[model samples]
Target: MITKILPGTNIELKSGARDADLSVTGVVAMALPLHWGGRVTVIHAGDNTLYPLGYKISDPALKLVREVMNGAKQLILYRLNTVGAKASAEVSTGVTAEAVFPGTRGNDLSVVVSASGEKWLVKTYFGTQEVDSQIISAAADFSPYYVALSGTGTLAAATVKLTGGTDGAVESDYTGFFAELEKREYNVICSTDSDRAADVVSFVKEQNANRAYVQGVVTGVHPDSEAIYVCNSTGGVTADYELTPAESCATLAGLIAQAGVQTSLTYHRGITGWTDVKPHLTIDQQTGRTQNGEVLFVPLYGSPSVLYDITSLTTFDEDHPKDFGKGLVMRTLQKYQSDLQKLLDTRCVGKIRNSVEGRAQIKAMVFEMTSRGYLAPGYMEDFSADDITVTAGTERDAVSVVVGIKAVDTVDKIYVTVTAL
Candidate 1:
């Protein structure tokens, strides 16, 4: 052997790490008692912004937040304020203060100032309960939820109660809200109001088409839309807060956040521990509505629980039958497609050629998922090596792939027959 200078080859081993990031996260948008507008924020478990409650809607997102923190690993929140809402305010001798945000929650604030030694004691009250107190020698030192102080007038022995804080007619800034939401990724999107139910459903459909699939849960009935789950909740007034159809939607959002994609909320409790059916309906009504793809919170074992895990899909097309209307099946399909896309991006993009090796890689991925039960075995019944095709596209520097997938549906019902022997 001749000892000649040779170049060394670098060999590296690489593998793809599986991620469940999208499967365990959820997003909810609603009116909150915070700075208004279409402001979007992310809150994991134990965030202080949701603390020191003061308003009735203080934790407007309390239902969704609590469930996500306890169940789902992450959550995205949107605080929506109606356009042109007036902030509540109180004018005192030496101080002028306004509510932090525009909402009827501000009308409940009361501000009182008293002399304490060398400093003036300013106290903030939320419907008779003192929530904040500050010692101040001048207006600049006053900071409380009841008011934002200003001016040089004497605050000594002065009390001012807020009034005229009208909550702007409830209007949803769907245009702004959706614009902000589309930038983020989430497993589920939940909203209570039906005002923009069509928009929400349409957005989810668009996301799916773009290969960024997301599911939605809504309250009240909406026109049939795939990937959108509908639930009919009570619109009755309760002692603490009115149980509107929207609030019902929020409750379902929280439930979905905690439960796994493979898990069903059927027979699960509503977020508020509410177990009794309000505006009480008979069994026949609940059954009929659910069969029509309405998610009802009916009494199960004398406890309030979800009636079914259904989607707003009533397709009559042969290609997409009613059986594919089930929420569980759609979710399974979404996850399956997501995995396939990931494989393409990570394992096939530039490293693999659009040849036999590339096709084998695609087939191997499908085999792995099916073996692990992510995809049903039925998919492999007639699927041969030719089932996966990775070919060069007509477009410059483009490749195309064709894949066939089959999903196993959740066994919602079963019929059994027995005869006396």
Candidate 2:
């Protein structure tokens, strides 16, 4: 008698883990690459201050960082090289010093060497303030925080100021930034350069098509796409700070990033750290701007608040309803899509078999996940088990899943009637 050989039973375990939080804001700016040597750096919750990260207050990126942190806790900064010149100075014989980073801010740096008895005192100054000082016995033992040292020799007492530093030309093409940005997950992106409006719109559209679900915030130019938010307010000067239109875009991006799926940035949503907006718009002006799909900082309830959480999507078809223009609804939809994709990629993609039972399992899993994650939190409503369907595709290895969801929106308007008897 011959016995047939059988394949061993394989048990694949699936994880019930969820994706990372979707509340990160990305900033693409022409910033000096100081301590972080790479093109990208992530600033955690408490480390939002630029001075601690080797960035002076005079740096061009300082304002952008401050504006973004005013609303968001976490930030991912993309360093756009300006092709600028580095500031350097020759200090005494056999010693040369250069700014730690490039750009015009380095031009404010100066190196002063003074004789310190048995040792040498090297002081690095930013204008009149002495930022860094190191007492060293020899050039080889010298280490400075603000500048890099080269060409070692006997130390001498002299003062040398950095020169020939320039900001150079800002990059017009954002192909590289977009490529690197796609590798990471962020809810919103904004650039300090208003000139990159068209490129930013194109990037947002491509990303949304791929289901990446990121929004772009810009100023001035109007690109009527649901994926883009245009800030049209001609900024304002507060008591402590003055903002331009581009800076306002960064602030709006931050606010959008911090807003959860359950919240809407309308009426009651006020910009953090800003008390008022200058040159307030009239009622008619606000109405006209809103109709044009522009976001404005208007006075609401005696405070500077968002007029409406709107996107530049004036032309809407049946597939893209008027609700799609609302930032709150878009956030809810993007979160759901991103989370579902993550669930499939992690749990169901290669592990599940292409059978009726597997399809049923997928549908049940998605329904339960949505109920617990979204419905329970009030981000979504009117969802039922029938809203999700998983079916077999033409290819045996492929599966098609269709999900329908009703995102909950905030009540921004009310009408009341009073009759006197």
Candidate 3:
């Protein structure tokens, strides 16, 4: 059954079970940086903090929505008390020691089962910003005892000798080892050091072109590596079905854009293979997706455009009227084809007021304005959640706008078209 995160309530997280029980600890569906409306539902769980008020499962098709690793550190409780409970007696966690995970894009969820045939489903989060299939894209070796190694072909350079445990066939050749990789039924995280990441890119590109390759966004991307790193974005020059050349990264700005009125969205990255991985920032809600037209990413410091859409922590209460900013921010970092707000700030004839409640409120306000064309550059309409002071002679506060993160009964997916410069 699907778990629901009701609007307008603050709840702490505990632990949960995979099948019928979810621990008392609220399950975190997606990571942080997620924007929710009053009715948004959660698909994952996490340790106690504040979970949007949650409800129990009633649907079976969505039962396995979140990945459940067999040996990961999750809990196995039947349920918890008031979702907002701050009590410790109602919490528990799994102590298994295996590398299994699950990840999801939209409703598409998959798990990373280990070489030991352990199954998993990482709890995923959908952020206010858009997520792409791209990531750090570095692969390393998982030696005996979950050992980590570097450099490509290292498995070929050495023999893996297993003592006290059942060992399978060993390959002394790198090519042979990798070929065996494709044949293995389990999702094995194998890696070897390489002087340049270019070779890694070549290997991925040679593997497939139609389908975007999976880069290790989390595992091993860093600067000052004693080992080499490479850029592997090269591929056939076919135009991105959803993007144009003008929308490509002009600097360190990577982007994920929408192309149709409401397009199908997906997330792909190496988060699944992270396996008790290292230092990484957790952003974006695990199961939440953005309004159809929203874009999300990090931007250059001096970017002439708006980056970082802060839509987390919005409160959506039904009895209370929530003035939601239809569309406010873009989540992706890149050279944007359309600066939805910049166009509004200067073009619209209303004074910009910070009437929103929180960091997330501002984003909610902006989004609300954009969706109704009040925030568009060409329009002069005003929006409001509440009546406010006008600078003496300024245009009467159009609509005293207030925003919260409750999904509209008739929410629409957003999209944008890319044009090559």
CA lDDT, every model vs. true structure: 0.61, 0.75, 0.23
Worst 10 residues of 2 by lDDT: 28-37
Question: What are the per-residue Cα lDDT tens digits for candidate 2 across 1-421?
Answer: 2344787665666776554443333333223233322356676555724334445433444656767766666677765654667788888677888876666767778988899999989998877888878998876777756677788677789899998766665455777777778677777878656678888888888888988878888877878888889986646455567787677887787778777575788985457667777558899988888888898887778777888888999889998899999989988888788788878777788988989999998898789879998999998899999899888999989999999999999997889899999
Top of the candidates by lDDT: 2
Give stretches of model 2 more than 4 Å off: 1-41, 48-61, 79-81, 112-123, 128-144, 157-159, 192-194
Q: Tens-digit lDDT track for model 1 on 1-421?
A: 2444787765566775653232323444443434332245566555554222232232543543443344444567666654435354545664677765555666777777888998888888877778789898888776645467878876667787777665454444467667776677677777666766767787778888898777787765665766787866443232344455566666666666555345666666544545355666688887777667777766667666676777777754887788567665676667667666766676656866566666566666655554454534332234444556566678645677776655555556779999899
Q: At residue 198, what lDDT does model 1 achieve?
A: 69
Rank candidates by TM-score, best first: 2, 1, 3
Number of clashing pairs per prediction, in order: 3, 0, 93
Residue 261: error of model 2 in Å?
A: 1.4
The best-first sequence of candidates by lDDT reads: 2, 1, 3
The pairs that clash in candidate 2 are: none
Top TM-score: which candidate number? 2
- Model 3's lDDT to the true fold? 0.23
